[model samples]
Target: MKMSNLAVDICGVKLKNPIIAASGTFGFGEAFTSYMDISRIGAITVTGITLEPRLGNPPPRIAETPSGILNSVGLQNPGINYFLDAELPELRKYDTAIIVNINGNTIDEYCSLARILDSHPIDLIELNISCPNVKEGGLAFGAHPDTVYEVTKAVKANTKKPLIVKLTPNTSDIRETAKAAVEAGCDGLSLINTLLGMAIDIKKRRPILANITGGLSGPAIKPIALRMVWEVAQVVDVPIVGMGGIMDGTDAVEFLLAGATGIGVGTANLVDPTACVDILDELKDYMIENKIEDIRDLIGALRI
Candidate 1:
């Protein structure tokens, strides 16, 4: 691996780069191992896991839109027990950091999952309060400030590992949601989860997704994600992980400028399996071109 000024320390966890494969997009970090070197990227957030195995939403779960895509996969996973028994061992083979994204329908469920992962080999536990695909507990818990605080506090109490609260864009005030999570004791924050969106098949006169509505991801939400990250960064003292429509190094750089300690690649992974590695290379090139000695110098460097 060619060395560069891309190393970063997010909440005491060191990353070779700032680019991570966002949750829900990267399935346990196995699918892309053949296409590219997984260790080259900063980190990988596995698919969201629940207390029990989920069959997920019905078919036609994805629809492509202008500059983005909408998905309502519904947090399909083989449950945490299966993950710890089967997936975690295989994922640990890679040299990259493994951060698991966990989802639940209740505060107790969230705490349970956190406690289970606390003693495991995973490097971090990302709370998925922002996922919009589920009917309950996912976005429902994240939409309100009080519920966000309660759930975050509950999970933080159960886990010794670093906790990162993923924030939803559907809420009335993302700042309030971020503040609540921070106050509740999250060590870090990631924003923004896909925006609520829908697509209709005009020929059939119905919605394209079986769930009626899905979360919008990709380039379309970058501006909103950057704005929210900037807003939360101003109010919170913990590190921020910025994501949404980040397709290239420049987009990742934009997030860092807006005050993100790290960046995540989501829909871009669906477009090209090697997107994360490619973006990291480009980031290094940018830093070299700018004569920047350290990537950390770019974090929160955006000037009004």
Candidate 2:
């Protein structure tokens, strides 16, 4: 067995590699055990969990677009307590970093969730500020810098665990949100979440998703995600976890050059359950072929 030394220190969590399973894709980490070597993954970020279990939206929760997927899952989850009691216990059996991705409807909700998980034996906590801001009457917090900082600061007050604020790409200025999160004491950043989009059934003249509008994810959003990663990298000092429509080793490398310390595999996992592990393997090959000894050497290596 050969080790390629692709380790990364993300918000104090030292991962064996730089490839992570994007939130809301890999389930609770146990789901990937049947298809791939789960331990090879740098981390497996669970699906977005709220305070309570949610059945999610109604039928037609997903719409297949030209080159991507539109999802209005309504932040469905098994709930935080279920995760802490059952899922977390199962994940502790493995050595891979277990990242808990959380969402809330209000600032106090964010704070409560953070405080609840503060004592858990988890490696990191990722704040999904992209969730609907109930105080704003359903506007997503990540769409505005003020709400972004508010949620981040609220959560920071409750937990000592590393907090990584995940940002959405629908904002007017992604850099402003990144700066806001960093100033609020976020240990890291992850972007970009799904872009706001809607698909309409021309025959019926109605929206495809149950919620009418859904977040667009996959290859179609890759260009936009990469651009945000580059822009946010210049303004924020924290490590960035970049993902949008990454499916292969090449996409991972592109993110690294864009100044991301790590890359998340989202829609790609649905395409191939072993996506993250395979990406890490391909990354190792790329490093050896390029005469690079460490993966960190490739981060921000891009030049004009």
Candidate 3:
């Protein structure tokens, strides 16, 4: 017997399963098609986009820490038009849902971006409030409850599509941010974005990343992400998309135990673009071995 039925709903969008490839690492959701049947996983969130194309931050934008990598990619992307004209149509060939992750430097930026996708055939609009909020005098919009409320409110009011708020791990109270977004009208929350961290070069006596500090991701952040997911789960009823250094089915299972309805595989994709398929395979085996009839039964079912 197999236990492959792990379908879960996030903001009314039903995924074939709860495991998904996170943005940034998945490259517009088309790059991994040859490695595996793209439709086998849940939904795919494309890399973050902006109103216009971006070259991203300068080189040395990535640094390898002990168990993770620090990146300041600056959300480099080909802009929304490219996605609309090129990526979306091809991706629509599959039955899976394609979500565009949008980032902005200002409130109007968030609203304007939402308006762009308002009538588009996308499944959801994920506001990247984790982008440092200059509107809050350079504080990350996802860092504070107030900023989360305001940004989410603006986007929610502007767009009719399901709005998902991607939260940052830098905050002291992720649960507070989760509640704030929901209060501000967010339909769901994807959390545990890269932790703020840095790496160094002893020979240069300077930081390794050009940005000095960057988002830390990969297996190193899994434990903390799980704890945060569980904590946020206790506070909010909205669906949670848990991610951070998730590299295998076991990692995905850990996130489910922490109350995450869906799991995003980020750095693991970079480690092996095929990790999603392998993780899916492992998940099947684990379910059957445990005598679990359906994977959803494992979600948020940890007994302690």
Candidate 4:
């Protein structure tokens, strides 16, 4: 079958394939270009960007679990201005869609970043609502439906580009936040951000991560990610980008079957720089073996 059959669209943004390099792992797509052809993958969601540059957490911010890793990277980036001026121009030369992942400490900061990116040539805006809300007593904006709606609506109003809200899994009900985002005018949703977890340094008699806790990701979280994506897909009418512990082509297929219109490869990238394209190739092979004509046929095709 032709590779063109792998094409898929997310929130009106066309991707060559359903495989997207998940945020924070791909590092703006430039780092992987040396390992493989970056253009072969679908879209690229750069590292989480803030209004200002961050020094990130102190040392020992990452620890390896049985099948995954815990990370408290603290949203370190060169800030949006540096990204637009230094990174985005080079990223534009590539053939994949550019999804800028933006984070803010307050609602107004989110809105301001949206307005600033509105005039840029980026293909999509992914709101990283997992960031702590400074104005709301240090709670993540995505933890509650009300705050999710408030931030989604505020950011939506400030930008004309298609907005994709990345939902945090550290909530009581993931479905509610998904519904809240769509109701507030979000064009699409990405589910199953890292689950709250930590590692203890048994020898050191202390927590491994400096923050005492971090986001857990890897094959260990795939089951939870798939369940959340399937649940959210049942309730929301918008497109869903499913990510978490996706380490290979089979993992990507599972997410697609679970109702992800787009598959996000996260921890897998850190394991292998060429993981995105490799997963895309494996997905194409799966389609050929299954005689699937189009990649869209796999979306929500799970046997219930």
List residue ranges in candidate 1 displaced over 4 A. Answer: 1-3
Specify the highest-TM-score model's number. Answer: 1
lDDT per residue (tens digit) for residues 125-202 in model 2: 999877431233124678888888888888898999999999888788999999999999999999988888899999
Relative to the true structure, candidate 1 reaches a TM of 0.98
* Higher-ranked by lDDT: 1 or 2: 1
Clashes of 2: 0
What is the clash count for each candidate, in the order shown?
A: 1, 0, 1, 1
Runs of candidate 3 exceeding 4 Å displacement = 132-139
TM-scores of the models, in the order given:
0.98, 0.96, 0.95, 0.97
Task: Pick out the ten consecutive residues of candidate 4 with the lowest summed lDDT.
Answer: 131-140
Overall lDDT per candidate, in order of appearance: 0.93, 0.87, 0.84, 0.88
What would the per-residue lDDT of candidate 3 be over residues 1-304, giving only the tens digit for each residue? 5435778888999888887778888987778888888888788889988888878888788887777988888888998899899988988897787778888878888788899999899998888877531233223688899989998998899999999899998888888989999999998899878888888899999988877788889988988999999999899989899998888889888888888888888888888978877888887778878788776687788787
Q: Write the per-residue lDDT of candidate 1 for residues 1-304, one digit (tens) a residue.
A: 3445788887779998889999999999889999999989888999999989999999899999999999999999999999999999998998898889999988899999999998899999999998889988889999999999999999999999999999999999999999999899999999999999999999999999999999999999999999999998899999999999999999989999999998899999999999999998888888888888788899999899
RMSD of each: 1.4, 1.8, 1.9, 1.7
Worst 10 residues of 2 by lDDT: 131-140
